[model samples]
Target: MSGIEPVEHMARISGGIVNWRKLLLIAAVTLVSILYIPDAEQLWSAWLRQEEFSHGPLMFLVALYLLWRRRVLLDYPDRRGTILGVGAILLAVFVYALSIKAGIQNTRHLGFLLLIFGLFLTFGGVTYARFVFPSLILLPFVVPPPSFLNSNLSYGLQLFSSDLSVSWLRWVGVTVFQDGNIIDLGTLRLQVAEACSGLRYLYPMVGLGVLTAMLFDIPLWKRGLFVGIAAGVAIIMNSVRIFLTGLFVEITDMGISEGFFHLFEGWVFFLFSFVVTLGLCWITLKRSERKSLGRGVMSVPEPTGREPAPMALVPVTVALILCILFLPLATYLRHLEPSIPARASFNSFPLKINGMIAEEDLLPGVEQEILQLSDYFLGHYRTGEGPPITLFAGYYEQQSAGKTPHSPRVCIPSGGWKIEDLQTISLPRGDTTVPINRVLIGKGDQKLLVYYWFQQRGTFIANEYMAKFNLLWGGLTSSRTDGALIRLSLPLRSEQEIPEAEKRLAGFTQEVFRILPAYVPD
Candidate 1:
């Protein structure tokens, strides 16, 4: 009985010892994580204000939560020694530094991955890195696909959705005509633009699904089913929203479909989608047994009732040093890049209007008033007229830069007014051609300048790879002011060109304004 009592006492002593080392390591990690987290916070705030898609802190929180739940797994015997763990941490630091220097997209994304890797090395070692490699699959979701890929995909989606909706409406005995992203449904027209592609919700919906499947320990097949279901729900909800918007436009004379429908209905659909997702998650949990498993089995021998090793204190101290050093390091690095130029401004004249304007006032004897209205809306206004009218000339010019053909042109067909016209013009640059579009409004004396320019041959949009890389290079590889100029030419009738032109411009714009209502009444 005395020998057994000694063993029991030892077990009791082991159980009573505090895991101070782990606690210190955790404290250190939390402090460093705080430093790394601020960048994501700004990004998240910006994302909330935007109508476009951007997944912010959601991924970070999920990763942290999962890691916390798997804490016991870290106690398992690591095949590699602590030296290997330290080496892994160093390598991750190098990767993070390189990614930062390169100004890579989703810098936070790479940082988070390296963070997870570093912690594993600093604590869990080689076997943990191997086991957690599945997290790499989530990386692609973080760095959004290249802009070219997204743009093409979005454009295709817009075209497809427009055609599909138009065809469906026509089949249902409604008069419908397909035109690019717009669908004409007799009394009202519907646009299935890029935003209507359900892209804004894609990342979150898919992300939540993935997290749910992993959390609940659902079978891979069921996980896929859940994701597919979520995607279907997103698509169906988007279509219903669009349909209702179109119906509202048809039923009401107020044009509520354009603005109010977009603003409120988006929130409504998002809410509905969220509820559907939660319901699915509940159903998943009902079928799950090991889904809520707390943690992995611990392999470490229990501690005796002795003080923890000084190694516990080391992590906390190092973490504090890092936190203290990080801000200065980041600020110095920021100075290495040149400041981005401020955005240009456009001057506007004061004018007032009461109702929608007639197209004939601007077109001057256009046979098809509806078609003329389309042209007017699509046309750009200049102080004086010579070149044809362009609506989105700036967009076209940006797109046309750099191509095999000496001159590139894009023609847009307006089905509402039934006229097709070339909208973009490409002009030759050094080795590449710059695309330009001219928009003209008001006959004879009034003309407006709208120009788009790109300095780099291959890069067109702000989000392009070359563009982002060029931004990092501080306009060294690419010109900083490498953009096109928008010019408006107004012909002067008198010797006082500037004053006379300003007066005529003021009067012309004011007249134009009076013709068109400033706000749509609903």
Candidate 2:
């Protein structure tokens, strides 16, 4: 071979090497950061258990594919800023440590976001422009909104859904009585609880939007519009499902609004959203030039076999190795024992909620349970059954703690006739007005009461702290004493009730206390 020909061949080989490095860099960064996603465990569990919510890992794979498909775009010549990316990594480490100290639930998610955003800004160079969709797409999944915000949103959605459903019912000429998140239709009353709020659809649909966005190359404004439309479509469709379920119940003597309807409504809404999104995308495509909309025939570049830059490989390898090291650590962190303070700090005297148990005899075949109330919370018993009743288990503390500056004093005019209002409570004795809120409103006679001190210290943010409290509260409430302060009338009761309940509650509280030590008087 000629000497000139030999040099040309070497140049091509060097270019191929450069291209490979870039791809590897992108892959390594993504792989490491992916572990930190907010619902990583749930995602993995879904995949493992073959559950309905198993589309999580597919999202990462799609992002990876998007990056690969735009290899040329990523290979663009541009300035690289390693320092900024390093700073992001450093910042993430700092936040992660702080999260551990503060007991933040999704610390890894925060870290992952910082890392991805930082890497794209710094290391990704000009390639960042091509990959913005993937970043946005992955963000919602990675950084789950804090539980406090999520609960508030869910609560709000419940209200919104109820209103929407009520409006539709009236439109169909049905008389409806609305109370909070519940709607009463002569024969049927629908409570728009967490299951009906369409939250289950939000995360997955957002993901679908991201995937759809990546597949289509449209102007930013149009893309935003499409995404908004898709989300709106999901929500609206869910509202309609809520309305239709009510209608179905009213129309059919069969209880279609209850069990299977709940399960079927989810799928129906999902399908409706999918169809609407596709329809919108098609309309948008038809309205714009095919090429401009990125829906036209695309050109395929020649396989240059260009390798990636050597300098990029070092960092990519380092990142992958570091991520491999941290994966186990992240898992360990998630399972770490709750600090002792959060665990043992249930002794905020004056008012305390003691326990709860299901009383089948009180209202046979329906859920009948009572929650012990303390003056700690100026409160009301939330209507529900089982652990961490609300999505925002954290918020109850602030509502219950008597620490908020301007919280309302909730009182039940009549104590539902089950148990007479005891003027004085002797357990954990203290001189404080026990403000209680109890209600009986279910097929079977069901009653719950919440009593707490009505006072406030400052602005409060409920979070994992509330979850810890819930763990203890749930355990204690389920326990029944042979002759405890509250002997729940049971059809068939067991002797191992109070001690077992206390033991379980203690264990759960201990788990939380590992993260948060009980507030001992410092």
User: Which candidate gets the maximum lDDT versus the true structure?
Assistant: 2
lDDT of 2: 0.46
Report the C-alpha lDDT of model 2 over 102-131, residue by residue, as the tens digit.
344454456666666555544454344335
Candidate 2 C-alpha error for residue 269, in Å: 3.1
lDDT of 1 at 61: 60
Query: Which 10 residues in a row give candidate 2 its minimum summed lDDT?
Result: 480-489
TM-score for each of the candidates: 0.54, 0.59
Which ranges of candidate 2 are over 4 A from the true structure?
1-39, 46-54, 72-78, 113-124, 128-136, 256-264, 289-338, 342-522
Error of 2 at 1 (Å): 9.7
TM-score, cand. 1 vs. native: 0.54
